[model samples]
Target: MLSKQLTTCLAVGVGILGLGFARSNVAVAQEKVTLVERFDAANPYRVELKVRLSGRLAVAFEKGKPPEVLPFSGSSTLVYDEKVLPADEPRTAKAIRVYRETEFARTIDGKEQKADIRPAVRRMVVLRSERGKKVPFSPDGPLTWSEIDLIRTDLFSLALVTGLLPAKPVSPGDKWNASPNAVGDLTDFDPIEEGGLVVEFLSVVTLNNKKYAKLQISGTVKGVTDDGPSRQQLSGTAYFDLEANRLTYLNLKGVHELLGPDGKTTGRVDGTFVMTRGPASRGDGLTPTDLQGIALSPTPENSLLLYDNPDFGVKFLHPRRWRVGTVQGKQLTIEESGGGGILLTAESNSTLPTPEQYLTESRAYLAKQKWTVNGSDQPRRISDTPDRVDRFAIDAEVDKQHVQMEYAVVAQAVGGATIAARLPWAEREELRKDVDRIIKSLQIIKRIEK
Candidate 1:
C-alpha cells in the first residue's frame, strides 16, 4: 500500500513540472513589440472639438454638453506609415483612426449639466504637409479614449505629443521631426515648434527611479498672439515601458517668445509637458495623494533658512524690527540702523579648508573687485564651540565706507561645507555682534524618541 501511494505522488509532481514547461514555452513564443509598433498599430482618429466659451459666444445645443474635468482627459491620434495609407487615396482608404473623449461641467439656461462625450470613429484626410514631399498618412480618424484623456489632462495636445517621442543621445546636425506640421520657417520661438520643430538628443538620465533619454529641439513659430514670429525651444526626457510595450513617460519643458500687435516678438510664455501610460493596477489613476500642498511663506520673526532640496537645512531668528529683502541667490535680508545691511547666503565648498586657508582663497577672490582689506583679527568661537573665527576690515574706496566683518567659519571632517551669512561693509561691526550672538545660540534639536 505504501509503495502504491508513493508512485501516485511522483506522477502528480511530474505532471506539474511538464505543465510549467509548456507555459514557459508559450510565453517565450509571444513576440516582443516595440513602442513604435504599438503606437502605429493602434487605431488613429480625430474630432471636431468645440468647447463652450462662457462670458462670450451664444448658447446653442450644437455646442453639446460641457465635458467633465476628469483627471487624465484628453485627445490623441496615432501616426501610421504613409506607405500603407497614402493621402491621395479615396476617403474610405485614406481614413485615419483616432481616440478622443471630453468631460466637462456646463451651465445651460441656469441648469448645470455634466457630460462625457466620446467619438465612435471619425475620418479625415491630410490636406497639407509642411514638407513638399508625397503626403504620408491622413490626419483623419476616430478618437481613442487614451487620446481624449491626454488632451483634457494636458493643457496642449501638440506640445504633449512632441514631448512623448524618443530622445536617445544623438550627435549634432542630426535632423528630427518635432511636430505634426513640420515644414514652416521656425527660428525664434519657444520649446515647441513655431513653424518647423527639430530636436537632437543630448543626454540620458535616470530619474524617479526610471531611465530616460533627453533631447534638445528648436524652431520658430507664431508668438502667443496672432502677431509676429518667435523662436521656441524644447528640452527634456522621454522613455518607453518594456512591460506595457508603450511610450511611458515624456517630460518636456521650455519657453517661447510672445508676440505683440505690431508683428514683433514681445516677452515669453513658458510651458511644460508630462505624458505617461494610463493606470494599470486597480485604484491606480490620479488620486488625492497626487496633489501637492501649497508652500507657506515664512513669518517675519521666523525667516526661511533653506529651501533647496538634496541638502536642505534652515535656521530662523527674531528679526528685532529689521527690514528684510532678498540678496542675489540667497534669502534672509536685513537692514541695520547703522546704515549697514546683512546678507545671509548658503555657500558650498568642494573641500572644507581651514579658516585661514578659506579666508585666503576668499580674500583673493574679493580682492579682484578692488575692495581693500584694512585689518584682520580673531573673534570668539560660536556654535559647537567652533575651532576658529576670523575678523576683517573692508574699506570701500569707491562707495566710501568703513566695514568690519566677522566669519565664524566651522570646520567639518567632510569634504564639503557651507557658510550662512554675508554682510555689507558699512555696518559690519554692529551686524557682526548680532550674528555672533545668533550663532552662539544655535542648538541642534533632536526629535523626541518614540
Candidate 2:
C-alpha cells in the first residue's frame, strides 16, 4: 500500500510540469505579433499636446564675472484637429490642421506672463514646407510671433508618428533602430549630425482597458536648429495601440542644450512632453462641412506671417523669412534671415510730422549713430487716406558695411509710428517685393490699454 501511494504522487507532479510548459509556449506566441503603421486618409484625428519645462538660464552681468543662474518655467497646451491628405509619397504627405485652442505661459522672477493670441489666425489652414520644416499659414492673415513659436518646433506630425514603428514583427525584448527622420522630428533636430535612438519592445500591457505595445527609447544626438547647434539626450516610452494600429501615446523627457560657436554649452533646457492622438470626438472642430472649400495649396500672400500688435497701435504682414525680435521701449525689431531687418518706434505726439520734416529728423538720428549717408532720396507720400504714410530711401555706410535703409512714418490723429528697414545693398532688389509687402500692409489701430 505504501509503494502505490508514492507512485501516484510522482505521476501528479509530472502532469503539473507539463501544463506549465504549455502555458509558457502560449505566452511566447502572443508576444510575437506583427506591428505595422496604417493610416486612413478618410479618418480625421484630434491631437492633444502638452509640454512643461523648468531650467536655469545662465546670465553674465559682468564680462569676467561668473554667470548668474536664473530659474524659469514655461508650459504650453495645444489642441488641434488634423486630417491626413493624400500624397505622392506616404512619408512626406502633408496634412490640413486647424487649431482649436492654444495656450502658452512663462514664469520668471516669480511672475507668470501668458501669451496674448488674436483670434483671426486660428482659422483653418494648410501647412506648407519651408526648408523641410512645416509652417502653418492661412489666406486670412499671417500668424503672430506667439502663434508661430508654438508650432515652430517640437510638433510631432503624422509622418513622424508612422516613422517610429518597426518595419518587421517585434517580440518582447526585441530591439531595433527607430527611424532617423522620426528621431530628428521628435527632437526638433534637422539633419541629425550623429547618434540615433534604439527602441526596445518592453512588453504588451493593458492601460485604460486597451492593450498597448510598450516601447523604450534612449539616445543622444547632436544637430543643427534654426536657433543654432543643439545637443539633446532623450529617454522616453511610446505606447502603440495594438487594436487601433496607431501610435496613440508618447511621453518624452529630455535635456536640450544649446551650443555656441566654440561648442560650449550656452544654455540647457530640461523638459517633458506628453502627447495623445486619436479619432476626433464630436465638436472637436474639423467636421466634413467645415473642411469644405479650404485651399490646400499655398499662395505667396497666404504664406506670409502676420504681426498684430494692438497695444502699440500697429500691425503688419511679413514673409516667412523674417522673424520678430526684441522690443525695447516703444521700438520693435523684425529681422530676416538674410541680414535684413526693420526697426519700428511709436510715439504719442499728436502733432504729426510732414514727409520732409520726418526725413530730416531720421537722417540726423542716423548720423548721430555714426552712419555716413552716401545718398538720400526725396520723401514721397505713399498714401493720404485714414493715415498719412511717407517714405524715403537712404544709402549709408555703417561699421564698414554698405546698407540700404528705408524710412517711413505713418501719422495718425492721436500718435504716429516711425519705420526703419535695413538690408544689404546687394540684396535690396532681391528682397524688394517682400519688403514692400510688409510696408504696404502696415496699419495703425486704437491703442488697447492692458
Candidate 3:
C-alpha cells in the first residue's frame, strides 16, 4: 500500500470519471468570487472517500531476497461523520468517528480479500483540536497509532483541501499564492523544488444544477523516505460546492518517482485517487442506507463491540459477548462465550512464508495429535489476506457421551493485517451467521512509520 497519509492526500483526492463541466450545454459564469471557507457548524460533514489504486509497487523486504513486485487494482471506501467547531483560532472536531463503517479490499496477484472494520473499532472517540495545528486530538485515551493517523489524515484532508480557497475575493482568471505551510503540510513541500504550488480561479460552472467554483490546483514535493528519495507532483481540477464550503468532487493525476543517489528516477507510481463527499451519518437519529442486503458487503448492524489498534493499523468488530485477550502483544484473540473465537495479528514484513506453506505444516502437527483433517480445500476469500480453511474432527467426552466435534482452522497473509479464525462445532449451528458477520467486518490500515 502507498504510505497512509500520502495515499489520502494524493490518491483519494483524484477524480476517476474524467468528466469535465466544459460541456457545450452549460455556460461558464465569469463573476467575482470570494471563496469564503466556512462549513455548517450545526451538521456533521459526512464524507465518503473512494480511492482506486492500480500499478506495480516495488516493495523491498529482506536483506538478500529481491523486492516483491505486486500488481493491484481496487477501490476502498471509508465513511466519516465529523463535525468541526466554529472557526475561532483553529478548527477542531466536536465529536468525530468513523460514521458508517470502514471497508477495504484488494486483489493481489489473483487473490482478493476484503473486510468491514466497524465491529472492532469504537466509533465514540472524542476529538479535540489544539491551537495553530489542524490535527485533532482525542481526549478519550487509548488511540492506536494508526487511528491517530487516520484521524489526522481526515482532519488534514479537510483543512488542506479547504485551504485552497483564496484569502481575498477575485474574478475568474485570477491566481493566488496558496499557503506554503498548508501545501508543505500535505505534500511535505521541498523548498528546493522549482515552481511553487498555486491555485487558479476557473470560471464557475453549473453541474447537476448546483453552482460550484471550479479550481485548478498544482503543486510539487520532492523528498526522501527511508526507502529512497521521491518526487511527487499533483495537478488537477476540483469542484468546490459554493454553498457547502467543501470539496464536492476532485480529479487529480499524481506521479511519484523513486530517485537514486544521483537524483534519477528508478521506479514510478502512476495512480488516481478519486473522492466523493456525501452526507454525514452522525447517529443523530439518521442512518445511511444500502441497496438490498449485500452479503460480504457493508450493511447495518446493531450495537456491538469495537477493538481499534492503530499502531498495527487494524480494527475490527465482534459481538459484545466475545472476550478480547492477547496471546502476544500484537497477536490478539477474541473468544466466544462458550466455544471458539478469532485470532488476529499484524505483520509488516511481506517476505514471510506463503499461506499454503504455513497451512501444510499446521495440518501435519494437528494430525499427530489424533485430529483427522476433513473436507476439500476450497476457494473462499477472507478479510485482507489470501486464506483457506479446513475442517478437522476431534473426539471428546461431553455429558459422559463420546462425540466428534468439528473445528475450522484458517491462516492467511497480506500486506496489512493477517487473520486466523476458527468456528467451533458447539456454536457452529447457533452462531453460524454471527461468525460470518464478525469476520466480514475486519478492517486494515497501513501503519505509519516514524
By lDDT, the best candidate is: 2
Quality of model 1 by C-alpha lDDT: 0.36
Task: Give the alpha carbon lDDT tens digit for every residue of 139-244 in model 2.
Answer: 4566666666666674646557756788888888999888866776777777688988888887776533446677788889899876578899988877676877
Q: Estimate, for each residue in 1-450, the C-alpha lDDT of model 3 and write its tens digit.
A: 222322332332332233433465245666677777555545555555666666655566787765676665555667666554434334453434444657667776667866443343434333334321333322222233334344433434445555667888778888986665455444443442544567898777654455667788787777654356778788877666676566766566777676766787666667665555544534442222321232211123433445666666666666545766665755677787766666665554453335554455545655775555553253233433353443333344434433333333343333333444455555556555555555555555554222
Model 2, total clashes: 1
Off by over 4 Å in 1: 1-86, 89-100, 103-233, 241-246, 254-256, 261-270, 277-450
lDDT agreement with native, every candidate:
0.36, 0.72, 0.53
Off by over 4 Å in 3: 1-25, 64-69, 72-74, 86-95, 107-116, 120-157, 180-196, 224-228, 278-450
Candidate structures ordered by lDDT, highest first? 2, 3, 1
Of the two candidates 2 and 3, the one with more favorable lDDT, higher being better, is: 2
Prediction 1 TM-score vs. true: 0.27
Q: Whole-model lDDT for model 3 versus the true structure? A: 0.53
Q: Model 2: what TM-score?
A: 0.77
**Candidate 1 residue lDDT tens string, 65-175:** 532322122222222111112334233122222223345564544556553423322211222222311111112222223233323222222223433343443432344
Q: Which stretches of candidate 2 lie over 4 Å from their true place?
A: 1-32, 59-66, 86-93, 123-132, 206-211, 222-232, 253-271, 283-288, 349-351, 361-378, 394-405, 423-425, 446-450
Q: What is the TM-score ranking, best to worst?
A: 2, 3, 1
**Ten consecutive residues with minimal summed lDDT in candidate 1?**
132-141
